[model samples]
Target: MIDAIMPDSVRTAGRALQVWDRWLLGCTFVLLALGVTMVYSASIAYAEREMQNSAYYLIRHVSFAILGLVLMVFVMHTRIRWWEKSGPFLLLLGIASLCLVLVPGINAHVNGSSRWIRLGIVNIQPSEFMKLFMVVYLAGYLVRKQEALRNFTQGIVMVSLVVAVIGTLLLLEPDMGTLVVMTVTVFAMLFLGGVRFWHFMLVLAVGLGGMAVLAVISPYRMGRVTSFLDPWADPFNSGFQLVQALIAFGRGELFGVGVGASVQKLFYLPAAHTDFVFAVLAEELGLMAVLGVIVLFGIIFARAFVIAHQAEAAGQLYSARLAQGLGLLFASQAMINMGVNMGLMPTKGLTLPFLSYGGSSLLASCMAMGLLLLIGREARAAAWGRT
Candidate 1:
């Protein structure tokens, strides 16, 4: 208490460091730095061939990372109440960005999906921001509708419609991976907000049914399913990526081959720096390095959960829920990416968070990390008292 009598600047500095979320900030920096190093390693070969520079992807990814860090710091220092105030505006912006991506002149096309908007200097993926926007808006929405949560007709049906609208737009991107992750994040937050059991069950049933229909309607998705069931059926064709990914892990027994020494990255493993980066990581860094990555993510989740609990205990429910939602997002996306690499699940073109090489994804990851830090900051402030 005597510290309150100290100089204001020193007092504020002490308060910021003592805040509940310094650990999360530290962890995020460490993971992000590691991600930069690995992205450079995984992308150097491809960048050199395609872009005429080994540092092409690395430079771009690092640039985005820097931008993301700035966003995180800005958000961390912002008031949570301010986010709540701007919820609808953010939601509208997210939806508009999504719609713009579908526009002919604006949207950037990659592979088969038109999921980005080419803004003069950079292509922006609105869906990435939509992920966080949906989470924050949903949290605020659910909190406002808490009284109605126990109501069967008003709450349940209403939320289902909300999910349907968002799901439809996401599916239009034909990004089943992001849609699935977003669905899970929403449902989890709603469930924890006391949305009730039967409602979740009903939503799950409808969602799965919709997913099935989507899969059957798309030839490529159907091929993914078929390939998943029997990758060896078309060993040299549709199954090549999985087969190569498996071989990457098989070769990385105990110690890794060595950092940046991956043979698979020599153009054999498709998306060696993006969707299937984990496979390249396994091949180059070995099994232990892969395990290390898993461990790092685990620590991140642990820290996030701790922050959530502390925020809740400190009476900051919004901050608490925000932390939890971000944690789930991180955990779920990582699991999906890793599962695809391991062939434990059907392939979904989801980037492995910060570790993957993609501008939109990297920016989105930075935004999410920023939100997490914001929540952490509030939790810390509440824990230690305002300076």
Candidate 2:
């Protein structure tokens, strides 16, 4: 047993594992910290004005972040197989919660939309959690049907039916923005899973047609479409918020007025703490800071794609597809929120990922990140055979 042979494979594998783990964990903490600081800065003015306590929103956000951090650690430490195995059950629970939010006396109606469940101190938006659950569920389903995925009938029918059913519920809430994002997430996953292109196109056409019909049937939606074209036309009415958002951005030049120094938060921007938080961010932090936010999200997208590539190379197709889909979901939502704030797109009540204020959004987004971390870890383990 004294051969003293060299094992180059083991030594090289160990180095690769170390590198992956370092990159993934470092990125996770950096993103979380950025979220906390930005959320606190973005919400302070609204909190002081509305609640008469500047620390109110900050404390709540910190508490939620702590809770989310715990959940993240739990997910990261847990077995990847567990998430894959439990995907179906979680999907069922998510669907049930989504249904419960629709039932009278059980749901909380905020601003004419019944999208939450009030449980005394906390109101939970099931849709936020539903997104992560759907991602996990679809990932598992696609992997299970990898062979059948090549078949037109089974693949399109099953996938299309799920999207249609979920799309109806979200549309009934009249959450057109979220419905569109969710449809994009599912189709993105399906495309990554090797579904035929023509089938996906058929689904897209139907979805676009449905959106057009909904716009006609709903007067408010039609108004939004009109406002999108020329918000200045109705400066004092339907377009007020859009015009105000533009003003906020214009006020903030290269360098912002400084943190907690946004003028728009003084009632100029409606939904200051929620949907339009990005405008407040721009007003306070300036255009440079706004660009920074975009860049940070860009880094996240790039890292996620790296994970996907690694996972695919390792032959873990489900993890790769799920990771990629989630990256798209998070990045796309952020862009949509920012675009709406900048008046580049029609406004819908979508929160900016990570930086927006909301308990459910915070918790659900953290959970998605947890799942993302798990995928990244699995990729590392697969590539280098390390735990």
Alpha-carbon TM-score of each model against the true structure: 0.92, 0.91
Model 1 regions more than 4 Å off:
1-17
Model 1 clashes, total count = 2
What do the candidate models score in CA lDDT, each in turn? Answer: 0.79, 0.78
Q: Compose the digit string of candidate 1's lDDT tens values, residues 242-275.
A: 9889988888777878888888878888888889
Cα lDDT tens digits, model 2, 1-387, are 111221112245335333224444555566566666666766677677779998887788778878986787677667667878898898889878888888999898898898888899888988888888888888888889988876777667787887777778887765777877787788878877888888878877887898889889999999998898899999889999999889989888888888778787777888877788778778877888889878877877787888889888998888887788778878878888888998888889888777777888878887777777778777776777633
Residue 122, candidate 1: Cα error in Å is 1.8
Model 1: which residue pairs collide?
A: 20-380, 256-286
Error of 1 at 101 (Å): 0.8
Report the number of clashing residue pairs per model: 2, 0
For candidate 2, report its TM-score. Answer: 0.91
